[model samples]
Target chain A: MQLSNRLIKWLISGPPLVFLLIFFVAPSLIMIVTSFRLPGEFGGLAPLTIFSEHTSIDSGLTLETYQFFLSDWIYLEIFLKSFFIATLTTIICIAMAYPLALLIANSPRKFRNLMIMLVVLPFASNFLIRVYAWMIILGPESTLSHVINHILGVLGLEPVTLLFSPFAVLIGMVYVHLPFMILPLYTNLEKHDPILLDAAQDLGANRWQQFWCVTWPLSLPGIFSGSALVFIPVLGMFAIPDILGGTGDIMIGNLIKDQFLGTRDWPFGSTLSIMLTIAVLGATVFFTWLARSVMRSP
Target chain B: MKEIADIPEKTMRHSSPLLRLIAMLVYAFLYIPLCIVIVFSFNDSKLNAEWVGFTLHWYQTLWHDHEMLLAVRNSLFIACCASTSATILGTMAGLAIHRYKLKVLPILAFTPLAMPEILLGVSLLLFYLQVLNLTLGLLSIILAHTTFCIGFVAIIVRARLQGMDESIFEAARDLGATPWQAFYHVTLPLIKPAIIAGALMSFTLSIDDFVITFFTKGIGEPILPIQIYTMIKVAVTPEVNAISTLLMLLTLTLIILASRFDSSMLRDPSR
Candidate 1:
C-alpha cells in the first residue's frame, strides 16, 4: 500500500514537473548562457568553437554584452524611462482604482460579486483590443482629439497630436492594467472589518482620519500587491508602446523586442532580457522589504 | 454574516457623493473603450472615427477574408490542444501540491504566472530554434501555451482542493479502497468543476495570447492575434474592430462559462 501510494505521488507530479523543466527551466537557463555568448554572423549566437570558422575570432562565452550595456548610456536611459513609466502608471492606477475598490467593497454583499465581475469583464476582451481602443480615441480624427484641440485652438494654443505620444502610451498602459490594480485592492478592502471603522468614528475621528489611521494602513498589503502587478507587467510591456507610442516613447520592452525580432541580435536580446529579469526581481524584493518594514514600523 | 448584518446602516452607507462620482468615472474608464469597439464594429465607416451609420460591412469583410479565417482556425486548434494538455498536467500538479510536501513542483507551477509574458515568449523562442531545432508553427505554439497555462490551471484546481472537505478523502482511505481507486472514484468527481474552469480559462488565455505566440509562430501560419497585430500595426480599419468585437464575444462567453462552473475559483485572489 505504501509503495503504491508513493508510485501514485510520482504519477501525479511527474508530468508537469517534466514539462516545465523542459520548456520553462531549460529555456531560462539557455537564455542566461546565450546572454554571455557573442552574436552570430546573421542573428543567433556565434559558434562556440574555432574549428567551425576559418578565422580565429573570439567566440565562446564573454561579458561583451554586459560591457556594451554598461558602456552605452542609451540602454540605461531606456531602463530608467521604463521604470518612470511603470511608476507613473502604477500611481495613476492606484488613484483610479482605490475609490472604485472601496465602493465595491463597501457595497451590499449581494452586489459585490456582480460589481467585481463587471470590473473583470472588460479584461475578457483581447489585450490588443483594449490598447487599440485608445488608438481610436486618441486619433486626430476622433472626437476626443478634435474636442481637446478645438478648445486649445480657441485659446490660441497649438494643437497637440494625441495618437502616437508618451501621453497615449500612458493611457494605453493605464487602461489595460487597471483591472489588475482594482482586483487586488478590492480583494484586500473587502476583508476589512467594518467594526474598526465604527470604533474610530466613535472615538471622534473624522472620515479622513479614520481612513488614514485604520483603513489605509490595513489595505497596504493589497496596495503593494496591486502595485507589483501593474508595475512589473508595465515594465516588461511591449505591445502598448509598440502600437501607441511615438518613436521617442520606446521602453525597455521595445528595446529588447527590437534586438530579437527587428535587429536579430539574439545575444543582445538575451542580455536585455536578463537585465529585465533582474530589474523585475529586484523591484519585487525591494517592495516586499519596504512593505515589511512599513508594516513593522507601525 | 451576522457581524456584517450587525454593522450600522450609517456605516454601510459610507459611499460619499464624491467617492461615488470617482468610482463611476473609473467604471467608465474601464468600459468605454470596449463599448466603443463593439459599437464601432457595426459602423459604416473606413476610419472608425464616427458613427456614420449601422452596418455589418466590416464583419462581412472579416468573414470573407481567407487569411483571417485561416488564422481563426489555427487559433482554435492551438487553444483546444494547449488547453487539453494543460488541463491534464495542471490537475496533476495541483493535486500533487495539495496532497504532498513537494517544493519544486509548486514553484515550477506558479513562477510562470508571475513572470512577464514576453520573457516566456522569448525564452521559448530561443529554446525551440536553438535547442529542439523544431520548426516553429502550431506545434511550437501549442507547447509554449501549455507551459504558461499550466500555472493558471494549477492555481484554480489548488484553490478548489483547498476548499474541499478532507475528511471524505480520509474516510475513503479507511474504507479499504486502493489509492488509485479512491482518486478515481472520489477526488476526480469532486475536482471536476475546477478542471472545467481551468480548461475554459486556458482556452481563453491561449486564444487571446499574442506576445508568446508572436515569438514562437513561424512565417507560414496566420495565428489570430498575430494577424490582428499585423493589421493594426500596418493600418487602422473597421475590420480590426470587427474582429476584436467577435474575439471579445468568444472570450466573454468562455469567461462567463468558467465563472458559472466555479464562481469562487475565478475570484480567487491567488489567481
Candidate 2:
C-alpha cells in the first residue's frame, strides 16, 4: 500500500516537475552561466573552445559584463528612469483605481458584476493593438489631435506633438496596466463590510475619519499587491515604450531588447536581464516587508 | 423606524459627484482606446488620418492578406497545443499538491507567475539556441508558453481542488472502490469545469502573448501579434485595425465563456 501510494504521488507530480526543470529552471541557469562567459566575435558568447579553456582557469568566467553594466552611468540612468516610470505608473493607477473600486464595491449587487466585467473586458484585447489604438488617437494628424490643435489655434497657442513622446509612453503604460491594479483592489474592496463604516460613524467618527480609520486600513493588502503587479510589469515592459516612446524615452527593457536583437550581444543582454530580475526581486521583498510592517502597526 | 433606516441611504447619496465623474473618466480611459481601434477598422481612410466614410474595405483587404491569415492560423495552432499540454500537466500537479501537501510544490508552481516576461523570454531563448541547439519556431514558442501557462492552470486548478470536499473520494473508497476508480468517477467529474476554465484561460493568454513569443519564435512564421507589430513598425494601416478588432472579438467571446464556466463551478457545491 505504501509503495502504491508513493507510486501514485510520483505519477502525478513527476511530469510537471521534470518539465519545469528542463524548460524553466535549466533555461534560467543557462542564461546566468552565459552571462559570465566572454563575448565572442559576433556578439554572442565566445566559442565552446574558449569556454572550455576558461573552465580550467577559474571556470572560464569573467566579471567584464557585470563590470561594464555597473560602471556605465548611462545604464544606471536607464535603470533609474525605468524605476521612476514604474513608480509613477503605480501611483497613478492606485489613485485612479481606489475610488473606482470603492464605487463598484458599494454598488448594488446586480450591477457589481457588470461593472467589473466592463473593467476587465478591455484586458481581453491584444496588448500591442491597444497601444496601437493610442498611437492613432495621439497621432498629430488624427482626429483627437486635430481637435486639440484647432482649439489651441483658436486660443493662439502652438500645436503640440503627441505621439512618440514620453507623455504618450506614460499614458500607454498606465492604460495597459490599469486593469492589473483595479482587479486586486476590487477584490480587496469587495469584501469590505458596510457595517464597519457604520460602527466607526457611531463611535463619533466623521466621514474622513471613518475612511481613514476603516476603509484605508482595510485595503492596504490590495494596494500592496496591486502596486506590485503594476509596478514590476511596467518596470520590465518593452512593447509600450517601443511603440509609443521616442529616443529620449528609452527604458531598461528597450536597452535589453536592443542588446539581444539589434546588437546581438547575448551576454550583455543576459546581464541586463539578470540585473532586472534582481532589482524586481529586491523590490518585491521590500514591498512584502513594508506591507507586513504596515499591517502590524496600530 | 423609517427615519432611522433612511440614514444609511442618505449617507450613500452623499457620495461625491466628483468621485462619480472620476469613475466615469476611468472607465473611459480603460475603454476608449479599444473603441477607437474598432471604429478605425471601418474608417475608409488609408492613412487613418480622417474618416472618409464607413466601409469594410479594410476587412476585405485583411481577407486577402495571406501572411496575416497564416499568422492567425499559426497562433491558433500554437495556442491550442500549448493550452492543452499545460492544462494536463497542471491538473496533474494540482492534484498531487492537493493530496500530498508537498512543501516545495506551491513555490515551484508560482515561480513562473512572479518572474518577469522579459526574463523568461531571454532565458528561454538562450536555452534553446545555446544549450539545446533547438530551432526557434512554433515548437520553441509552444514550449515557452506552456511553461508559464502551466503555472496559471495549476493555480486555478489547485484553488478549485482546495474548495472541493475530500469526503467524496473517501465515500467512494468506503463503498468498496479502488483509489483509481474513486478518482476517475468522482474527482475527475468535479474538477472537469476547472480544467476547462484553465484551458480556456491558457488559450487566451497564449494567443495574446507577445514578449515571450517574440524572443523564442525564430523566423519561420509570425503569430498574429508579431505580424501586427511588424505592420505597425512599417506603417499604420486600417487593415491591421480590422484584424485586431477580429482578435478582440474572439478573445472577448472566449473570456465570457470561460467566466461562465468558472462561475458555474463556483455555484455548484456538490462537487
CAPRI band for model 1:
medium
Q: What's the DockQ for every one of the candidates?
A: 0.73, 0.49
- Range of the 10 consecutive residues with the lowest summed lDDT in candidate 2 chain B: B262-271
**C-alpha lDDT score of every prediction, in listed order:** 0.91, 0.85
Worst 10 residues of 2 chain A by lDDT: A48-57
> Could you tell me the lDDT of residue B190 within candidate 1?
94
- DockQ, 0 to 1 scale, candidate 1: 0.73
Worst 10 residues of 1 chain A by lDDT: A50-59
Per-residue lDDT tens digits of candidate 1, residues B1-271?
3445556677864588999999999999889988998999999989878899999999999989999999999999999999999999999999999999999999998888887889989999999988999999999999999998999898889989999998888899899887777888999999999999999999999999998998999998999999999999998889999999999989999999999988985564346
**Which CAPRI tier for candidate 2?**
medium
lDDT of 2 at B112: 78
Candidate No. with top DockQ? 1
lDDT of 1 at B191: 97
